[model samples]
Target chain A: MMEATNAELYRLVLTDAPYVIGAYAILWIAFVVYLSMVLARMMRLEKEVDLLESAVSKRSGE
Target chain B: MKQLRTAIVLVAIGGLLTTAAFLMAFFTAEVQQFGTVTLEQEVDTVFPVAPDQFQPPAGEGIAYVRPWFSQKIFYFHVPVAEASFLVLIISAVFAIRFLTSKRAEFDTKSRIAMETALVFVVLTMITGVLWTRASWGVWWEWEPRLTTYFIMMLMMIAYFVLRNSIEEEERRATYAAVFAVVAAINAPISFMITRVIPSNHPVVFQPGMASSNLLPFIIGQIGMLMIGYGIYTARMTEERLRERVEIAKEALEG
Candidate 1:
């Protein structure tokens, strides 16, 4: 009875493992994707700001 | 500049804490007993055929408490749900402030917070769906909490639609702020629906949770809040950079 009950625990863990792993995987992936997006946007804005600064400096020089 | 640094630090700390909570949930926390169910016939589950808790009669099984339903998902689900609710409130509060102050910064803050709220809400829904599948053996159900939370998600989506439809800046801000406030009302209602109405959804925040469960839950909640704030602040930093670019464009034109 004891050994079988323990096996039941193992079976339960194995059975539910997919849903548990899936939930956590989705969360971590979402964070990674979200952070990547923010970083990409920031980089684009930096490039634009650099271009604008040079243009402004060039204009003032002229 | 300092805020961005703080945000990074918070994200790092939050990530570590949540990871620890996840580990503890599986390793240290005792498997919670959800009580028993009386079955007219045998059910196919990973549970033992006849544990001590089982009541015996042929084809009539009194099942033992099954940890298979919510034990694992509860850690992630509850934290994300609470964080989403908190972030929604933050967005609504900023929206109200924007309305009163007529400040563009407040509007930016509110908008960024709304984006964060939406992200958390999506995560909550995803985790919740997984839980329902494991517990109820279905991908979707029209239970009270699920229905109300679905409405909340739709309202949030409509908020962005309303924002995108407007071209003028002030008008867009005004409309979005109002919409944000309206959409945020769903968070509290969705949260309380399980308690107020009958729900198959387990109500987890009552006084009787074991220390084993409560400890990890608290850690997970704190970590999620920090992560939410970190994300919001980081997004705000990006918005500030965009504003700088806009200012430079105006300077060139002037």
Candidate 2:
């Protein structure tokens, strides 16, 4: 009976492995998503600044 | 440009260090044993074995303990949690400066810091939940430590909502700054409450971590702080560019 119980516990541990993997997956995904959002915002802002600078120079020349 | 360059370097270094820490955790650190597993071994006695003796002496071994997978999450969760609180304190410092100086620049700094804090807080919550679920078999609990953190998260979100609701720029900054200060106060209270109240959360430092465990933890901490600072600087650069564009437009109009 004791041998069977120990074997069962070990099997449970193996079954629980996926939860551990899931936790790490969520962590990496959250960081990557945030990084991408920041990068996208930066690109949008850069385009806006370029357009505004060109507009300012064009108007000043006139 | 120089600030952006520095931020990039910090992020790259942080990434490398964190990867190294993760490797060490899996390959080098000892798996902490929490419960005992009984083992039967031969008993050597001075006298001859008696017929009444049914079994041999019991021996203890660390290898018999079940694998502690949840312990691995500690390396990441703790560093993120500490970084979140530190950033909150920094945001409050900028908030106080803004209140006294009433400079838009100070306000912008405070707001950016708070934004960084928000990101960390969210990450902390997610990781905390994962750890709790893995260890305790529950996804959510209303324990003091967790409840305090939930309140802190709400207050942070409310700070941004308050800023958005107000139309006047100065009034918005003032309200947000005050809220940030309140959030700062809440942060330490939340952290200390865990110590005051007994909780299931393992105290990693109370009993000194093994040197093998300490190395990865330290590496993770430094890496996490670098990433936090990198995120903050990147946002700051974007905000500054937006401000410059607004100024150029105003000059054109003038």
Candidate 3:
């Protein structure tokens, strides 16, 4: 009984390797980018709060 | 410091177990055989039964059915997939607690758990795609498991999207918590429906597994759970620190 060869099976599977790899790579990159954006926004908000505090202190002093 | 120590310990143990599982999968588990074949020099040769001389003995199969790399992927894939679902459930539990108690800590825990689940879900999707591509001919298929996972991936992404769209902290937490519970509930149903409605995709789970295969799988699962718990704890600690910082800033302003 002749069955499907290993090479034939390998060929069938190998074609989709790139797609799988590409999908994962893209997801990881997106996650990192989103994290960076969130960090940046938090920093900006902190700066704004500091500016507001200094302004209020100066007004009260005046 | 105590929490940090716990996190480090859990991570270390998890890493060690994962490594051990990988080694066991390769060296200990029996190589799975597919079917009997008759060797022929001609590529197109097809026969019901090629002569005895052409056959390699019944016991002496090919060196390996699947490649070493493909088989290795299985260890990581199944573990991460299981961990992702477990974390999702944890997140939903926290979400329910938050809704009932209206406690900030529960909300924080839920959010962190969801984030951890997201990381594992992405890992699951990647490994799943690789497995499918290797085992089946196609890169993407609308099989039950794949479809359900794809839906889960989207739902998780949507949870984050919903979070970003909301500005108020408490409101954001509440809405996210609600959504998390709904998504979590949907996950199992998705799995069940998919399995019930059969498709072209092959069902790999058999009635039982050999001891060698079972051991590695269990080890991998335990390691994955520990790693997931560690990540959740670490993220929660970071969030607590951020909250403290925010409170201090508010105090200074007030």
Candidate 4:
């Protein structure tokens, strides 16, 4: 295998072992956090939709 | 009930096959011989494997022959990568279906498949990173294959991001499906362009492996595909049930 000339770039970024692992860890954590937020918002919207439907039903019955 | 039963059966088969492949890799595969080097060489001097044993130097263009068991990563890596792409395609298919039919079920299937693809894509990245570290002495490289997979990982994440940003159910489904289809198209092009473009990265596609090596790889591939299918089916069933429950609740309220 030919040595990549740009191997120095990797060496520079990975100077600290923790940083390299941390990059991946951070990305995953962010993704999960974002997903949870989305799910929560969806649940809230569903509840609001239900409330609106119920309110309309009550008005019709009266 | 029938779909659940089918899913269970598929998962069982996948589990059995994967276990068999794992055993075959460890006990049956022949050790791949990386060429030997003298202890006094400059390359060996820099990247010493042990205090006494001669090993190739790090970052030197020397190939350290990996043990037979080291090859097992190949089985795991390729299968996960293949499965990831397969699931991506399935997601795209459902996305297209949703776009055409405007059906909730299609959207549900697309989302579940995307979720499953994410799992496999992560596995592929992990295994690919390990393989690069072990074989190439680098934790990460911007080589064609690596770069392409990296882009793919990001694209899939972006799909989720796009989905999250949308508040409306139908609009979110439509946009995510469109993105999924585009991503599915891009991944193969990424792979192809990487291979075609000339670069310094080492290509490891050997002409042929011994039967022992081949057997495990084949088993692993089949097992992974089966597992992927099983996961998709299981998730789809769960989504269907959730939709049914949602409909029932709405009906009761009505």
Candidate 5:
């Protein structure tokens, strides 16, 4: 009887595990993705300014 | 640079705390029973229907103490939802400040805060749906709390749309600020709807929680707030960088 009860509880846990896991996964993934986007934007902006400076300097020399 | 470093530090600490809370919620905290399940009517549940232990008789069955695995969701959901609301109010406060002072910085701050609020709100909605599915056996429902929160999300989206539709900076900022304040109004309404009106969404507030449960919940709340602040600050730094680039570009052209 005890083993059967434990088995039932385990089944319930497995059933609900997806939703719980999904929630945590979504939360963390969203945070990491957003942070990465911000970092990517910063890098691109820095690169753009660098290229812009070089282009202007090259034109001045020409 | 200094601000970005501080933001990173906060995010690291916040991430660790939230992760700790998540772990504690599963291993240390005791799950609360919202209510009992009865076999009187056909109901969808994760629990075994009329298990041997819960089986009363063929004709009649009493209410069973079915464990709610979804109760674990409460810790994270409550904190994220509250964080969203707090950030919305922050946006509105900055919006009001911008309207009064006519400062560009305040407008930017309001916009960033709104962005952060939207992110948290989306996270809340996702977790909320999962909770509903796990606990209530529904993927979506037109309940009061859910409906109010959906409206709040729409309002936040509309605020940004209003900002983009207008080309003039000052006019756009003014309109978005007004919309921000209006959207902030919905935050409280949505939060209170679960208590004020009859709703299936469990109210985690009002004491009576075991210290084990409360510890993870409190930690999650503080962690979420710190995360929200870190995201806000980092985004602000990025905005400042963009402004500098714009200034430099114009200087070159001139």
Candidate 6:
């Protein structure tokens, strides 16, 4: 009886493993994607700032 | 500039804390045991089956399936949901401030806050859907809490769409602010409505969560808040820098 119950408990753990792992995996992916997007936008804005700064300096020099 | 640097550090810390919480949840947290239900007959779950239904009959006749894997999701789901609501409230607060002051800076703050809120809302929805599938054995349900949350998500999307449809800057800001305030008001209603109306959503805290569960949950919540704040501040910095560039371009043209 003890051995049968132990086997049942082990099986339950295996069955539930996927759902638990999947939730954590999806959350990590979501965070990474959001971070990547913000970084990309920041980079684009940085490039724009550089161009604008150069243009302003050229205009003042002229 | 200093604010942006601080935000970056916060983001790093938040990410690390959340990762640690995830590890602790799996390694340390106890598997939840909500009331027991006995299977009357053969159920097709991968979990070990009782050799006979009558071999060990539960007193209530309802069989508690093995403590679910879905319970694990609560750690992540609850935190994301809370963070999303907090960001939305922040957005609405800024909206109210913008309306009172009629300042473009406030409008900018409101808009960036709204953007951050949208990202968190979407994450909440994704996590909620996953929980629904794992817990309720369905991918989606139009149950009270679910339906209310769906409406809240739509209102969020609508807020942005409303902003886009308008051609004038100030008019767009005003309309978006109003929508944001409405959405913010609706958020608490959507949350509390489940209390008044009988709902299927699991009330996690009323019965009490295990202390083992609470540690990771509290850690996850703090980390999520920090991450939310970091995202908002980072976006605001980028937006402000873009505005500066636009001003520079205008000055050169003049």
In model 4, residue pairs whose N, Cα or C atoms come closer than 3 Å (at least 3 residues apart or on different chains), thus clashing, are: B34-B65, B43-B57, B47-B57
Best of the two (3, 5) by TM-score: 5
Deviation in Å, model 3, residue B82 alpha carbon: 0.7
For A1-62, candidate 1 gives per-residue lDDT tens digits of: 12224445556546767888899889988987998788789888989999998899999899
In terms of lDDT, model 2 sits at 0.79
Docking class of 3: incorrect
TM-score of decoy 6:
0.87
* DockQ class, candidate 6: acceptable
Candidate 2 stretches greater than 4 Å from native: A1-10, B36-64
lDDT of 2 by residue, B135-194 (tens): 778999888889988999999999999999999999999999999999999888888887
lDDT of 5 by residue, B31-87 (tens): 655444555544444454544665656656444455778888888888999999999
Two-chain DockQ for each candidate model: 0.42, 0.41, 0.14, 0.06, 0.35, 0.41
**How well does candidate 6 reproduce the true complex, by DockQ?**
0.41
DockQ of 3: 0.14
What TM-score would every model get versus the actual structure?
Answer: 0.89, 0.87, 0.73, 0.69, 0.88, 0.87
Top model by TM-score, which number?
1
Higher TM-score: candidate 1 or 2? Answer: 1
Ranking by lDDT: 5, 1, 2, 6, 3, 4
Tens digits of lDDT, candidate 3, B1-254:
36656765776688678768877877897544433343333343222333455456564432223233355556667888778888999999999999999998999899889998998898778777776766564679987778878888899999999999999989999999999998898667655664578776444456677888888878988987887877676566556556656665665667
In model 2, what is the error at residue A7, expressed in angstroms? Answer: 6.4
TM-score of chain B of 1: 0.89
Pairs of colliding residues, candidate 5: none
